[model samples]
Target: MAGKGVFEEIIDGDVYKYYADGEWKKSASGKSVPIINPTTRKTQYKVQACTQEEVNKVMEAAKAAQKSWARTPLWKRAELLHKAAAILKDHRASIAECLVKEIAKPAKDAVTEVVRSGDLVSYTAEEGVRILGEGKFLVSDSFPGNERTKYCLSSKIPLGVVLAIPPFNYPVNLAVSKIAPALIAGNSLVLKPPTQGAVSALHMIYCFHLAGFPKGLISCVTGKGSEIGDFLTMHPGVNCISFTGGDTGIAISKKAGMIPLQMELGGKDACIVLEDADLDLTAANIVKGGFSYSGQRCTAVKVVLVMESVADALVDKVKAKVAKLTVGSPEEDCDITPVVTESSANFIEGLVMDAKEKGATFCQEYRREGNLIWPLLLDHVRPDMRIAWEEPFGPVLPVMRINSVEEGIHHCNASNFGLQGCVFTRDINKALMISDAMETGTVQINSAPARGPDHFPFQGLKDSGIGSQGITNSINMMTKIKSTVINLPSPSYTMG
Candidate 1:
């Protein structure tokens, strides 16, 4: 692995302290957590784990900051966000390098993610000024001749504090997706970056500060979520939460009382192939969607549901494509890289072995080295197998045969997760029918189920998530509607 070269360059002497009240400081309890570089499997940095006292201080600062940030003219806030986007663009290379070192994201994918985050920042900035609530004219006919009218107005107002918890997979993009919207919508933020990917997040926040955002308007508190997540969520000062992770979302909803939550949780997405589908194209997309970023994306296609008529042929095509994928350092040009941790590799390997024990045959050789598990394609994977239902979060794909499109849809909907799914066919009617019938948040007819543009609605269903998250939708999610009505008196009228 190319050691942390540019990663060390960016964070040279950068403070890893807990940021609050527009300043960085150590934890009141003097506690810290070691940040590991997944690629090198070495401890590269230490971030302070905020204690309860620091959590309170950060929330208090957020509450205070929200009052003024919310009062700032919407256009001014939008301008600041645009400035932040430009600053991020200037540091794009460094941020991408940090992602590769911090979370083991591939170099190309990391750079793309940085660009995506910048787009999100710019999108939210433009949306904040354009998507304002409009006024409505109301007429009352309570007494026929005695008429009265009222002018009503509605607009989105900031919710005081938003606690944004972003996952490790997309350290820069996901965190910025949340932070940019919250700030543009005039809400103060307390971002809790994934401990494993804090360095990239710190670099991102510093850009926001340099962009001239108001002090205390945004804070990034580094700590174990189990410790400070609940404390901050349950705090009286915090008004909303935007979390992107696993089952922790349910707990956050329960513990946070009645605050609004925008969460995008785990996904067990599926890629369904029909008999008439293009096998080579499907294979190519499956390999791209499944093995990219080592399958760490929430929308990664973990299972391939193929009709029995084309199962064998499709598996062969996929096997051929898998052979060409390179498994090595993320800094190199490779199809796969080391996953976030050794445990993820073990879990994925266990699932593959379990399928093998249960009569599933591997279409390709299973190669493992340290945290990198080369792409594995399991054919004849039964629905009862864990690999068929679980989110592997690694470079593995389970292929299951189905008799009909209905059977494939049934299998796809049977899981507790319903984040996203894809179907392949040339017939538009069948595509629409399958898309309408699939029990997921988003359905792709010919494309992989994955995150798209920053302006599109991105979310999940079932246990996958609570609310939508994109530029416009997220700004709406971070704000509350305030309605006002003004009564107007008319000249006296004779009864009809």
Candidate 2:
């Protein structure tokens, strides 16, 4: 088991070093970036900010380590991954504590995130071992002119090195989601965790380190994306990329030519409520989905489209639920905590103001305490309002009333993002109809939009993402199928 030494070092405010060549090394640049606590607006700690030259060194090291790491048997890789998962589970409390301070995640949710990450790692390992390479016999006799003499065998092989960039909203879970699959699939990894949540991610990476992965197989580089983002993505050493962020993903896509890319951009997930829907179920899901983690998730319910006939009743129920949500610092385990940064709060506030000016009605007085913006629920939001289309990524939910189910589906499809959406209704046929009609990747029948308790085939249709992501899907993306064809001897016609 990994000791808590590294976690203690980070919590004690020691300047943390980036992990490269399988060891923690001080940045050659001698510069560092502060990790801010959103709740207190204080520097929780600082991590080394590597220079471009340092990034180059880490990439070269990873590239050099790839062949040996890839040559390791799948069973051996799975064993290490299982060990890392156990270590992560053992350190859940310490990592969750760091998560609470670094990103303002509620204590309970932070703990859950760590545990879930462990499960993800474990699942990836188990799945990796079970994945079998395919083989098939190809016969030439089907063409009627040629004899059968060919055999084809296909096997999964790793893409050299995967560059994983995780968003601040889910640093541990998303980072591990990328790391576990890439490693289990026989590829080396370079993790560029979000600057805001780097410390927590570093702690997770330390578990892999303690699991005895080969030198340089896994590396962590911490720096401003502006400084190293382009260089890292465009670097020749990176064979593939698995990224989770917003506009940064767009920028990376343009620069990451030829390299296989798996990205999860932000989304404006919508929840549609039909007249026949149960108001209690709809409202409860809305509050839980929209307000949890202060609505920092990419799948958070950004907009609600409800039938105008039932909108009033649904709004009343939602408002009552929102009012009961406790608001305070994450240390207090409140339902609403400060967002990741003040700029995020500013961006969210701007969207709220735009909706208000366009005739949206607020259920509560607008409040802002630094990064902590008390949860706000808005009703009567029109299509013209920026909040209807924009992703606030904060503790605000907007309701837009519509005349029919078609209108709700149209509103969801018109958005540039098609990550996920949901429709609430009692009619099973109606739910399935809307589910098929919605342009988003996944649609919920009567529940608020969510990622999962199970790793289903999660994806986005358009600007939401570039590819699918789940335990199995990610492993497939990280590896390529290689086929070997053999020319067999043909039987003599005269012998028979």
Candidate 3:
């Protein structure tokens, strides 16, 4: 409340009275990290850097609240989600501001995120009713002389506590991706948002309380990833952990011990341009899909394989479009923005430099103003180059020329990441061929990878992630099935 916006509220038990639990307070650490504007590198506000113990308290409250919250009616639980969505929509302005300040995301992108966040909540609420179980049934019909046959229905139940770990990029939507489904499923949540972008999710939690949710039902702890992550994943009380970060996601999964897990790791997604494709349309879509979020999305296109005939033509068109994109402050409307961190900016610079040394020439040398790195293009990239194999997650696109569609498909599948990919071709057979050969979980034909409307089963194939998370998919990952049968002391079926 003291940092930026209005001091609103915090709630306790299924009510609207926000009781300040001291242990859940922001860090007492005097030193703070800068939350920068990627476009201008301007300091927004330095959030309180949380210690390990403070992060644990949120999960502790979750453990305390899980049993009682789980027993609440499914429909009633869903109502809280609906309420949260409504409140978030009403407070979109302030929340969007927080998002822009924290991560330097474009104003338009932030607004869309808030709306999509609400949609996620609504979707989860709808999916809640569908979790209903079937009635009991037995084998009485099969045996004419049998007097008894009963089998209890198999329906979903809460997985106690859910520790949701969201990334810095798209902080609001990614966090809600976990929160919505978990809350709708009647499970208490302990949200550990990125330390760099903690305010957005904090504002979201405040909105949740406004929607009449019990205080302990949803909680937050802002802190360093390594410390909070270790605590959350290894905690005995947490039944499952939902993670969305690159290396951090993997770390959480490994430390989950025996707990159920859901992960959405970053990717070096690819896009293929074929001979018969329209180069102009392909260029526009490529720019928007790849660098829309500074290439920070896990599904962002980092690799492009073009057919020999159209490689030069398509590259020129994409270069012209990339050059025209306006790079400015996230507060202002702009086609592109700066990379998220100074470290990230530096890394991209090094990657480009290294590639250039290895004969991969950039059409334009990357320009860096503080943390914001403008879009840079490089052609004649080989698979052996580090930039070709690794994920830049920045505004850098590297093109690799391939002779045939078959070779392009082979190169795309060679990477460890299997999150997303795209192909553009007039021939249905070629599209189908790449679709079958690509190792990724989600592949688009003439379209970029996306997770919109909150309905698809979004997951990865290999190292990208282990489990999936969406409206209904998130529910299924955290739950297991058990059979119940009542056969009137069924001695007839037993060999004994």
TM-score of each: 0.94, 0.96, 0.90
- Candidates' lDDT values, in order? 0.83, 0.88, 0.76
340 in model 3: Cα distance from truth in Å? Answer: 1.2
lDDT (tens digit, per residue) of candidate 2 on 2-86: 1255554333236777899987888878788998989999888788888999988888888889889888988899999999999
Rank list by TM-score: 2, 1, 3
Residue-wise lDDT of candidate 1 within 363-462, one digit each (tens)?
7788888887888888889977899899999988899998989999999899999999999887889999999998898998887878877788988999
> Residue 320: error of model 2 in Å?
0.6
Candidate 1, position 40, lDDT: 74
1 or 3: which has the higher lDDT? 1
lDDT-based ranking:
2, 1, 3
Candidate 1 TM-score to native: 0.94
Residue-level lDDT tens digits of model 3 in 1-496: 2123443343122111212232234355543445566555667555455566655666666777777777888788877788889988887887888788778888888888998899888888888667633333445546677554444445667778888888889788988888888877778888777866676777777777678777577877655555555766777778888888887677667667787888888787889889999788888878878888787888888888999899889989998989888887787867567677889888888888888889997788768788778888889999778999889888888999999887888888888888989988878897887888999888888877776557788888777998876777887775655456654564445356
Off by over 4 Å in 3: 1-34, 39-42, 133-152, 489-496
Worst 10 residues of 3 by lDDT: 11-20
Task: Look at candidate 3 and tell me the lDDT of residue 465.
Answer: 90
Model 2 error, position 37 (Å)? 0.8
